[model samples]
Target: VAAPARRGRALTAAVVVAALVLFAVGGGAGFALTRALAGASLLPPPSAGAPSLPAITDEAPARVTTASAATANGEQGAEFTIEVGADWTSFLEQRANRGLAPSTVVHLVAPTGGYEVSVQRFADYYPRHSVEDYLSLVRSRWPKGQYFGEATDVTDPLDPAAPEPPVQFSYRTVEKATELGRAADAGGRDLRRSRYSRVLPRGADLWVVEVVFPTEQEEMGRSRLFDTIAGTFAVVG
Candidate 1:
């Protein structure tokens, strides 16, 4: 059986800003209280009679939509909006991928569990080249994964006008996950690498947008949540 996939990238400092948005209303007081509690002695364990925290499950998908502004300029530049589960919130604590253009990024977090997803845009340095070329460049940086499978177009179900476009594909790769600082998990990260990418054509300019998510859905053998979120991805002018 194929091993489960894991998250590959680190959360960038800029992305961390999103995580604080919800907490910003509480101000520094909430942060100060958390720190104070952490410094104090360990609290006693809860009694057996105490209620336990609810288990994290992927059986049902959450309904939440968050819109991000269009990055590429001009009449043909692509713009998009995505919806994540309501249980998931903004995950600001993500590391920046220096290779990508820091135009716009949306990170989502599973409040009840440790799952995250992100959408980011990268400038198309080789506007003259084909979309395949860009996909190859991005894959090259991911040296760890053993990629397998041919690229297939991810078409727009809502728009029949955009037919058989090679802007998206079915990408798969397997790689060791980053567990501890150095210890690598035996499970793979192919599912994580199953991100959806597209090149936005803005006149002569090109921009790439990527939607990334944890393999949590796959881990639970559930796909509804992932599919639900992915359904909202769009590249528009």
Candidate 2:
């Protein structure tokens, strides 16, 4: 009877061990199956390295289009005409000076509110001032801590032989604290501005044509829209 009881106890212990082994094997197989169904893997992950990024390339030139004629007349009977996009609206305003000649400003607002071209005509204090001289003054008046690119001479495509070519320069600014920036923020848009300016002598007065637009729309500013304004601008008194 004692031998029989020992055999029974050994058999019971063996059955318990077999059951645990089966449960572990089944559980591991179930976990692997679940991972496979969920698009995961039990294998090691790929080694870390630099992230893949898109290649950079130069942007293609924008298409040229013929602009429509537009004119702005100031209160002092001075007027200027330029070619602008058909969708633009022109507003003329006279700015009075304390003891100097009054100036005229023509704001050409773009359709979508992100771009504007302003034409300003003011008395040239220095009658002999060159484009470079005017540009130096303009640079001095710019707000500090802004990024300004080199000024370049842009020949008038319509009048290539003109003696004084327009001086063109660009600058960038973040307008998060301004009124325009506040409106942009409400609309979930960034208000970082990219501005392009051309300064040239227009008879006794100086003409400064500036284009301001969102930085994301830089290609539009670089298009023939600017070319038409700078090349076809004419002023008369």
Candidate 3:
């Protein structure tokens, strides 16, 4: 009877040890898997650079600086310069970090009116499209009732002798007053006039400058002001 009792004790001990071994191995595997998943989750997301516009380099991000002088008020960018009225304020458009390229959009706003100018630059490698081609593509995306004026050839402010001349055009569109940040009755819309210019500098990129203001301000001499501002766009580097 004593021998049978000892055998039973040994068997119970063996079973307990086996259960502990299995639990340790399983728990260790689960812990490793959890850590692997956590490490993967900590990884950064893919770059937000536009697929159509590849980044040229991993250099420091580009920035815009306000340049004010008694004779001129303008914004200087990494590759371009644009003159604005003394009351105009400039800011770089916020965009996702693209390690290869700097921000390409800049905005200049008038001090006391709903007038704004935006400048955008695009690389030449990806699309390889001409300025006229880009303008045509843009016009196709305008909303209904858009009135487009005849496009006219304009001298490139940066390179006046470039083989391909820049183009300028004016257009009118109706937009929601709320969209333009103007106070209006419910469902009211406003007529907006805009001038767009496409300049192909003597480089691997092109620029587009747009000026927008309320149509009501045209008679107040805003049109000439907008044109003068847009014409001041030039490539610096």
The candidate maximizing TM-score is 2
Model 2: pairs clashing at backbone N, Cα or C within 3 Å: none
Model 3 lDDT per residue over 1-237, tens place? 899999999999999999999999999778778878877543457754312311212132323333321111343334556766555677765333222223266777766546677776654412455666656656666765665553556654555654355666556666656667756654345655655554554444556677776655554433465556665665554
| Candidate 1 lDDT over residue span 105-209, tens digit each | 567766754444566544333444555555666667555636655365654443343222335554555555453233334322323435545554433334444
Model 1 misplacement above 4 A: 1-61, 69-79, 91-103, 112-115, 122-129, 144-150, 157-166, 173-193, 196-222, 234-237
TM-score of 3: 0.52
**Which candidate gets the maximum lDDT versus the true structure?**
2
Model 2, global lDDT: 0.60
Error of 1 at 78 (Å): 7.7
Instruction: Using lDDT as the measure, name the better of candidate 2 and candidate 3.
Output: 2
Whole-model lDDT for model 3 versus the true structure?
0.57
lDDT of 3 at 139: 68
lDDT of 1 at 29: 65
User: Model 2 over residues 114-179: C-alpha lDDT tens digits?
Assistant: 667887766643355556665565556546665455447554432244346666766777544444
Q: Sort all candidates by lDDT, best to worst.
A: 2, 3, 1
Model 1's alpha-carbon lDDT is 0.49
Model 2: lowest-lDDT 10 consecutive positions? 62-71
lDDT on C-alpha atoms for all candidate structures: 0.49, 0.60, 0.57
Please say which candidate is ahead in TM-score: 1 or 2: 2
